[model samples]
Target: MSRLTDLIARTKGNDPQLGADLEREFKALSSRLPYGLNFERHSPEAVELPLRPVRKGDKVRVLPERGSTKKGDQRLWQVKAIQKAKKLADLELLGPAKTETQSVALDDLVVVAEFRDTIYPGLVSTGKVERGGDKPFHTVINGENYHALKALTYAYRGKVDAIYIDPPYNSGAKDWKYNNDYVESDDLYRHSKWLAMMERRLLLAKDLLNPAESVLIVTIDEKEYLRLGLLLEQLFSYATIQMVSSQINPKGVSRGGSFRRSDEYLYFVMFGTARPCRMPLSSEWSTSTQSDLENSSEDGSPVTPDWTSMMRRGSEAYRNDRPSMFYPIYADPITRKISAVGAALPNGEHAAPPKKGLVAILPIRKDGSEGRWQIGASELESRIKQGRVRLGRSTSYGFVVNYLPDGAYADVISEKFLIQGYADDGSVIAFSEAGDLSRVASTQWKIASHNASENGSSLLATLLPKRKFPFPKSLYAVEDALRFFVLEKKDAVVLDFFSGSGTTAHAVMRLNRQDQGKRRCISITNNEVAADEQKALREQFLRPGDADWEKYGICDFITKPRVKAAITGKTPEGGSIKGDYKFTDEFPIADGFEENAEFFTLTYEAKSAVNHNLAYARIAPLLWLRAGAQGLRIDKLPPEGWALVNTYGLLTEVDAAAPFINAVRQAKALRVAYIVTDDDRRFQAIAQQLPRAVEPVRLYESYLTNFSFSNGE
Candidate 1:
């Protein structure tokens, strides 16, 4: 007997109650560690598990290789009894035919269970578009995003500058799927499933981000924002995290008996010194009027238009609230200018009058309530000496007090008062005591331009014509979010995994067009069919696995077409519907877009091929992508007799080694060369002959290790 069985038997004989309690505890713990017995699935060891004896009551399935099998033969079975000595078991057919039993060898049975990862890493190039130029080409990858991310890790690990993803919100209207089936609201572990899906992909994505200067932006609604926030915090503990509430829908969506939902959230996870740039305010808030004074010194000037309020208001504006700011100001009765200031006393009273000849001014509201001044007694004294404080018109009590103009005191006063005076041109004149004018960004964001369901749909419809995808993100919204980081780093690399309808890529293109920069984007998405399309396909007997199903799916039908139209300035029908951009004032809106991009699909290579005999063609595009997709093909040497890939080249033929070395020495741009040869002596010979600037690497020897993976079972 096994150790557990023997222990149970001993416990039962000693004390029946103890044995029952121990057995119950063991059963509960066993359920928690269900995958422990299948250690081979989780182990990192290179070897496979050896054959082992089947346990009684263990679930199994018959091998599909067995000939002449009945319809029910493929179903799961239970091991009723196992003869340890013979290595055979009495299997009772499960499900409909539970009464029947058959004696089968243990080798013919396999465990029926779930494992963490099912797909292997491999990439198959479906097609390519060669719009040759100095412009960087963007890539749209079609596959399961997880596997695509894994494949990309071999090439782009620690190199991406930014990643913006809009994952499924898990609203439970048959929107997202797990194991090829929609995860309905009634599912007991729906939330767990959503987390599991996001966790796996996010972990892979973490590997691709540049450790020192990268940012990850994730957008989510109320359904899973809390859980996702905690998850991001857990995974990225070393990074600085900030959450912003974005109003994507100002009108708001009505929920049952609850407040209308008008906002979603953005989690900006910054690594190292990555930060958002101070962008120019929106058009409505951009206009500003400069002061007329020129050549003013840093110190306060006599003719400076800058001024500030003398009285304080709001919550902490009372004398009892901040007694230090409630002192009295002495003004010259003849000049109507502040002459002296009194300090605050220990008993919450003002100090003795500065001079008996000057008039004392106290802060009092129109309702006869005591109030505080904007500055403390010491600051008031300094301003009085500089002639910054002056008396104004008399109140109903026939008393003159200090006052500042609406334009000059706007920054110190309430924003409501500033808006009242500057509402004509949306322009405000903010002056400093040093006589300088500066622009400040407003905290309040306008929500009209960020309507996702409406603006996003209209943007995609302009390119796609059919509205193929559901509820995409607003083009300007994503552009605005990325603009914070990409504004200065125009050549930065951006990635999007949940690239529904490819709005993120479209935004990147628009931003580059506006700035005349060479930014590159990489978008990954799965070809999952939409809910309505899936229902229609099922009605037509064309399920998910059917040969023609993928042709009608989102990645191919929606994402690829949208990206193509946006790049080439023409619709899929070969007609031009392109117009000028509207968002920028620097460029004409009617100039149209002139950009380039390529499309690719992910596929897997056999484990044997990747390990023993990997070919250059299988991994060339990956190299090209890593090189910023500068050129389309790596098949032939350039006209200069050497192929150039971002200052790197691979010399395939031994006969071309001399020419490659000569090219390396002649071309000032070349920095690295990969010599492809099986003979180590020949590789070293070429490596030694290369210039000091050019570093030679042996193909399939130096780089293949990065692409290796576990057995693709």
Candidate 2:
């Protein structure tokens, strides 16, 4: 037992909750080692939330009721006294004139919190930027993500479609509080803190995800990939786990005598019904003429232009096999032009003969048994309009019809084809232009084998030319990872707690632009400066919360601005960025996304006030996220005691239930409604009257219910 540990240990015994990693650090730091400038955030700058109640001498800052403050209420003040009855606190200025005092609502004040303290989280809108249109607002929250995740559980529990996190690799690099060089060992002392941190956040993250169908993507380097896998297994025991070794760092880092570390691990914890979607690979041999997979006829005959028999060949060719597909194709024998198609008959029933003037073409086999067409009646009609289905040759009854097999028939049924336009016959001319359908993503993703070896630094420089990070993920790499999951989920709710530099958000925007999807990304990061920078700031007598100090924090300095530049298509100086995105989809950088975004700072609120509806303003954004981050939000209490929007509604007063119910009936696309009341009977009565589609959530009770649970995290 080191003397340093003994000194910090509780009077009777050591604090059981205190991490053993901290104990090791206490010993080493006290052993007198030389400190380095390689540092990280000034934690105090992001938050000075000492987990204690406000007292007469505690220095604090006042808060704005609406929107985020630019310079924040930086003037220092002391908690003069508490008026419990009025629910107000008096704050005295901490300057030379100590007598000046003012009273403010206790709810507006944030006193910070500890584990024991139940925090009612609040959102302060910093600002917003829009590229236009009615896109759901992608959010970037600047706060300690641990508390922020807890807050999100109330809004997004059981609703998130995917969560992709690039957590700290826990390489034990020298930082603000460090006194040594980067340590590569994965010993208990180094790994314990990171594992514990991830365990806590992942557990909370579980509540946010849709257990029925969601994916948890975590990227880690060799430093903690093994530990992360074990921890993920421990936490998500029921999930289908798989690790993808992506060669993100193709040019491996030569760390002393060991092999150069290049590849990193991506662990995908897939929940129920969640699976990787197959992607298309542009065929090397495929030309515009060979877009169709086949070239010759089954009878060893030469090709006839771009047409193939409508009769399904090979296996499953019998009418009984696909009874509904054995329908008739109506064609004009004289003109050899298809007029219309007949409907599919029930099993054991025959298709009704075509009208008198039209000749019916049946899938009759040479062996004299009935066969089925390649597609159904409706599919044939659609293909006929595309000019894909046309007359092939004269048959006994009419001109035998054929359809253009431009691509794999199976792919046409299961994949999203890129439609070029309609042909003269109203046919949907399309192409399968990307990944090869038959190619599967291999477990060992070597850099030499894949095109995803994008330099993280070089890629970030394209979006943010002036800023940099210790490890910024390649934008294209994130976009590729997201495409596998969100490609099919147009409205997926993707979350990234460790959203350093807001790379995930930028990636989502690019994904949405490619497919025109509604996937909303929620990014959370702290506004903390680098350790060496913090040291420099302190030397100038600048402290946390100071404008200059806060400016360099990650959220203010990088994440928010990066996302803004992506959305507005301009640099901080309001000039077009000098480049185009050619990595995946080639587009000019100045051509910003047609998306909307809002910035927020997750702040502490009084739990009591939340239960009594006194903190509704602060909690509105949380509810908006829960209802799906689309359309307008219920950011303020409605004057009519209730509010209705495209996605959600709120009923503040049950007396106004009639109006609220009428509004609910009128809303064409309301998914969730919140009732602000204390009485369980009142809540149920109101809930029963609401439409079946509207999920009636008890606003105040919902807040407390989310807080009611506890776990070791």
Candidate 3:
């Protein structure tokens, strides 16, 4: 029988209850220890009968494996010693802290069970390869696509810097999908499902950011904007929120209802640091144009103006000088400050060329024939053909070109389109109809306004051509708002988890591409929705293929297969698309209290088995050994030529002159800690022999700090 079984049998004879209690304690203790030691029973009735035999050197698995350590903490223990009933068998486990051990009843303690041949199993070796160097440069890619967002989050946990997403307007359209299906009906669970989806990703996403960094920026309409805002508060407690307004279609009211509502609102949330220190607020605002850069005529001061003032005042001149640049802008029906657009102009749309105030008409041919110029036509044509055309200014004015021929440029550009308008009755009402050209447009956007840019429709068409993506945002409005936060040259990392059509990425790329900045971005997206319902009815269209579309759309590249095409920048099949940025997926093991722990063990010298009642008698042998080994100087000797350890576990000072101080007054013996309870004679004898010997301290002083000896000698 095992030692525990024998102990139990002995105890049961005297106190059956104590034996049962001891057995129960032992079982519970075993379960809590690490390793696979389970307790099985052939019969619950005869509990203490036959315990499978346990030999002295029987090998038994003990403790579980200790996983990786956290960033700054150290591993505490390699094995743990657990003591069960005082009489039962004791075991030492070599494994992780808080590991469990299963136990089988004596009757069923499978003697043939496998034993641990290896001391520590399942531990990760340090030789395992990592992704890159110990330190690596990280970057973030922003875009309004969801699948990409999910993929990135899954791939890189605890590595992202920012997360900015602006979802659909939720205008009763089939935009967002749930569970690989569309949210058709006003299903009460629809919103909840969306929240749950976000929750799943966010729970994982939260682990992705470093403790020092945070997430930022998620735009939404009022329909579900408030709900999203609250959700953000719950998810990211350290987030700071703000609403930015962007002019959609300057000429509001496209659906033709009452007053046109064009202004749109974007909800932005910044995470990590309390707030970005020294973030350029001007970048969030519209960038300055050429006209804005001109010096003030009054004092040669820079005549920089806000976007609205600049646009309104410069509208006339913008239209007259560059009629092709005119486009309508929209606003929100409720708040005039919020533009109908998602902010930022669409891709490939030409911005209004910086106004130079100088205007030059194509010189009419001398014969009144088109393209038949009089003097410098031949020279200009030759230059144009060679793509080096530079029309020379008049000899009177060096290289100066003028529209007003005044001092310096002012804030507003003259609006020729609106300046030369007439009513249907053939009556010119241009000046009268013209409102405050310098007044800032309403925060709420209008759909049916005349301040539309010439490329407005085309730009919108390029982004949301067939109105496939409901209430798609204008790139300009988003850019304008981003200007308030995103800087041009700084190493900013932008994130957008709720990417729609990859707009945020497009914007980030455009910003850097325009300025040649090295700003990086990260975008997360889940492919749960469809691009269109007609093709995949009730089916998920936002799948891996959709992500591929975006990736291929940008650079016509697929990172996975490009390794084979590295030399030629072509796939094995001779495909042209080749990805430059390496893409990878990762599953990182994170650190947490519940996930890992620190365990410990206690050790001391053991003496021959003897029922000794004296406190010092029970512990003196071990104390003496430690003192001799550690060379603790003291003047003491117990009755048996050893140091006495009192019941209190502390050493009694032999010298009355200095009770606390331990000094060597004897040549044969040394000072040591107190012993087990009850040996007074030994204490006195040691005191007589050695003058200043005191009880020794505990082994793990870092753990047991308050231990003391009670034999007050």
Q: Model 1 Cα displacement at 49 (Å)?
A: 25
The 0-to-1 C-alpha lDDT of every candidate, in the order given, reads: 0.66, 0.72, 0.34
TM-score per prediction, in order, is 0.66, 0.66, 0.33
Better of 1 and 2 by lDDT: 2
Off by over 4 Å in 3: 1-159, 202-205, 209-215, 253-259, 272-457, 460-471, 524-713
User: Could you give candidate 2's per-residue lDDT for residues 86-131 as a string of tens digits?
Assistant: 9878888765533778898765565533333356788989999876
The Cα RMSD in angstroms, rounded to one decimal, for candidate 2 relative to the true structure is 15.2
Comparing 2 with 3 on TM-score, the higher-scoring candidate is 2
